[model samples]
Target: MKRLLLVALLLFKWMTYAQTNLIKNGGFEAELSYWRGNDIATISPYDKKTGKNGCTINQYVGEQWKGIDQIIPLPKNTIALELSGWVKSDGVEKGKNEWNTGKFDIEFLSSGEKGIQNESIAAVVGTTPWTFYQKRVYVPDGASKLRIMLALGQTNGTLFFDDIKAIPITQEQLNKFQEEENTKRMAAIEPSKESKVTLFTNGDFENGNTAWRGNASTSNTVTKEGKAALMIQSSTFDWNGIDQIADVPEKATTITISGWLKSEKIQQGKDTWNNGLLNVAFAGNDNQKTGDDQNISFVTGTTDWTFYTKTFPLPSGTKKYRIMVALGFATGTLYADAINVTFN
Candidate 1:
């Protein structure tokens, strides 16, 4: 029995190792070996909720870029990347500049680790519990590397960080990262034209129910490229459809929601519930709706494939974004595909 248990334990460890992603030492389980740190950053032992050590930074001196840095190499055909981590703070205060705050900064690099361009960071400030932060970006056409810096830029605070993750976006994910200009602009836009990033999990349905859950079933019969869930509603208030909850970066600016929709035999929902529509609700870390839901209504009755794009302000303290391609309380069959959410 002892030998059997030992084998089981080893198998579990191997399984975990096989799942390791692009971000090295992501959970800080191995201390600070994989990172280069300055004087203000050190390892916080065994305080993380995951039972792993976390990297902590003390920003007292207002000017030193004193923190940690890690460089990630990218493979060819990598179109975008996803970043996420957990942050805890105590008595944090912003610096003189708007960009100076406790946060993660990403700067793209070319071959031989040369600088390409710096991406905007979502500032982390104030006292807070363990908060999850995430960002997604489009990779430059010829870029080859990424530098992730964890620092309290010009901000005075104590921050603890763990579970840093950086994942190269898949082809399916890139399908959802469309291009968008300002909210009022009306013109043809291409995703590759602007900042290449995302906070929304790619719901392009190309991966077939990868990051989505709920009653709707994945179907390829009527998809853009023969993919997406077969959206149907069995009853009202049951929220019968596919939905996804994704993490958003703190202090992110404009949020653009874009997707494709197809409807058939749709009817008015009970009371004033919109029939076939895309409903987005902002939520906190607990996954409970914290504000009223917003909608991009779909035309009633049958319609061919129609694309939609909506841009709105990122609500304050929005930790989780709830996206629903719901039928509301209406009886209908619709298909929602390639739903992409991006933030500036």
Candidate 2:
């Protein structure tokens, strides 16, 4: 009996030691402690997928790049390491330009010198649900440090990261984890039917702002496909806009808003920051703003009517949404027509 008790205690100790997180504050529960970055990222208590907190990186308008990183010393003679985390994003752009997307990366370093840097293979664009990502890398000989980084490079959007971990693993275990992750990803990508419902009234402005409000009027000066469109003509230097409240169906995961827009001699003023900018945004049921405002297009000069669209994830428990269109800090005329909102 004594021998069996000793074996059990030994097993418990081994398990506890193995489960220790190698990265300090890996779950971000301590609010950026042991992490290095600018104010571009913050600890969000309510935006986490797991634990009590998560890190959020924001790439606001006119910003170039932003990132948060941590460096830790490598264990002696470590052969391989596995890194994993959960991430979600909104409006993250993707292109050949590395600067135009959101990325999570791991790099091995020799003291302060850079070695291998591996970025997440999955393309993070538009709105996404919480997803798991994992990567295993072989530690090169003489490597002294490992760096974990999350960045929003040139993309105008937001990224949330949580439940991060890094640990040493054997090659066999890494291979098995990779295969399992790939299989799960493939299953998730299988196409499934999604029900789409329109939730806006008088979206086409055919009824002449019957269900709309704000500094807006109906006119024939600019129309996309109908005889009338919502028009906002700025005679003086004050912002003008329009909005309508609509219900969102329960269990809806995605929302898409679109419209046709045109501008004539839109001018930017020194006092106005977002001058000549036309944009759309989705607000919560309480008439409170939610998420980032999506800019359809900005007009500094005369331009013909153009169609613009944006897709965002509908927040959970959101029973109602307020759609808004506004003209900021400029003079001239802005026309919008054929507005559409869809929930899926």
Candidate 3:
């Protein structure tokens, strides 16, 4: 049993490692051993440097660059390269090439070129006492040589570099990095807490609002003397055939419908006992349909605001359904907040 458990643990670890992605921090380190200058040696005063703890190169103007001066060889399978370094500008801001900015620049040199193709960095020295800067470069295939230069760019003040790195990039790694960035952007737009959407107005039936239709007459769809209401015309009585509704998937296994209900009068002919009862049915006429209990509806209060809830199991062959708050067979005013459907 102990041996079996050990094998299982190793398998689990391997699975986790395989699923993990690149773009991880602190993956590679730069070696300053190749640097060649009297006044420069790679230094690390910034906290982002990978292995050497705070490795950095100290440089002074007119004394030749003193930081890490040599490029570390690329890995055997390396396809792309990204060179990043941190520099604090104390020297005068100068230098106009790819390698340097205000305080320091990094250069990449290939085997065939002698001038600065190996990649160099020069920076415009700033007066902030010390501030960090970073840069990244790409490398091509079949390239064998790499080098670093500190004084390639012209500047007047002291410059320092730390935490230098040369990283290998792959398509998969780039894609993963892009995906992480996209996720962060999306998370900022709609936080998980605000995922639920809410609408407070009662479809504009009350407050002198005119967004609802009733009995083919717009003049009295709303009332100020008593309670406001929404009425369905006899010609437009079918619930599923209504225009404001959208389709729900037939395979939806579970559903919940909840809203507020208050009515002074219900369909005029039905028993007053069942007048306030609301129904959510697939068919307009329950008698014509299966008349089964698959539909959900309830009646709660007569004069004041009352909450009502209904949940039902869907039939295997059911196609589409609509939400309805109908008075049995009577006529009356119903104020409602149509909040329906929550996904698990």
Candidate 4:
């Protein structure tokens, strides 16, 4: 019993420490002790997501990047890293360039890069209250260093960042995550009393596309429940679609997608791709698309509260999947609600 208790304590400590944030002054209460940057960045005491302070980045000139960065040495065998934090913006407008905005960027310094930095950026724009942002990427080959950058990129406005984190994920944690996902999926499928988890965020569109994004998509009152739903129009362009990227469990066997869709005035696409469907596109751990897309059933023409679902055997090498509502080339309006994705 004593030996079992020791092992249990050791396991608990390991699980707790595995997700410790690597950033030193991420909360900004330390006042920029470990971070480095230019005059555009400063510690703001008046507004913050947590604690006493937050990092603020502003660009009145809009001529250059106004932000800060911190370079951290990664631990040995860091499988993947998740960067996340809260962002609040005040009239943060971009320049003529599209990429200019509030950006939480990561650059992995790897020997295999040969000098070119591997960059992953999660950008925020316009005005918003306290909002959460996150990005997860696989560590590159021979990676030894990480450059965490937060900046207002050529945008004329004020932005505040707080409670940032750089979490190194291990294989053990990934296995546990996969196990939890399986539990949720099974709970949803079976008649058991286990509490089922809602796998997707804001799937019902009640938050008015808060968790969904696309050029041609907007939240409308025309919902199945008459509350709110995501409305997509093909007039934005051919292949106009809205999608959310979701992490796939490693070695996951199959995934099932389901949702209710409503369409009106959907026309023939240039390639007969015009329809309401789930396009499950696969991506590798490096977050690059593998060009393999499973286009589920099609809902063409006018429809009201039509249900669609499909189960696909996950393609090998998939570390993530993009769940998309696409109109292909068709011209019409589509409404989507209660989008769900479950794993098996």
Best by TM-score: 4
Total backbone collisions for each predicted model: 7, 0, 63, 0
The TM-score values for the models, in the order shown, are 0.47, 0.44, 0.35, 0.50
RMSD of each: 20.6, 21.4, 23.2, 14.2
Model 4 spans with C-alpha error above 4 angstroms: 1-18, 111-121, 183-344
Better candidate number, 2 or 4, judged by TM-score: 4
lDDT of each: 0.65, 0.67, 0.40, 0.69
Writing each residue's lDDT as its tens digit, candidate 4 over 285-334 gives: 55545545677667778887888888988777766677777776456788
User: Per-residue lDDT for 214-319 in model 2, tens only?
Assistant: 5578887568877998887774433456666566777788988888888887765432333555455444544444555555556555778888887778765555
lDDT value for model 4: 0.69
How close to the true structure is residue 234 of candidate 3, measured as C-alpha lDDT? 25
Q: Could you tell me how far off, in angstroms, the CA of residue 327 lies in candidate 3 after the best superposition? A: 57
Best by lDDT: 4
Off by over 4 Å in 2: 1-18, 119-123, 170-344
Off by over 4 Å in 1: 1-20, 61-63, 172-344
Clashing residue pairs in candidate 1 are 136-197, 136-198, 137-196, 137-197, 138-196, 138-197, 179-191
- Superposed Cα deviation of residue 205, candidate 1 (Å): 25
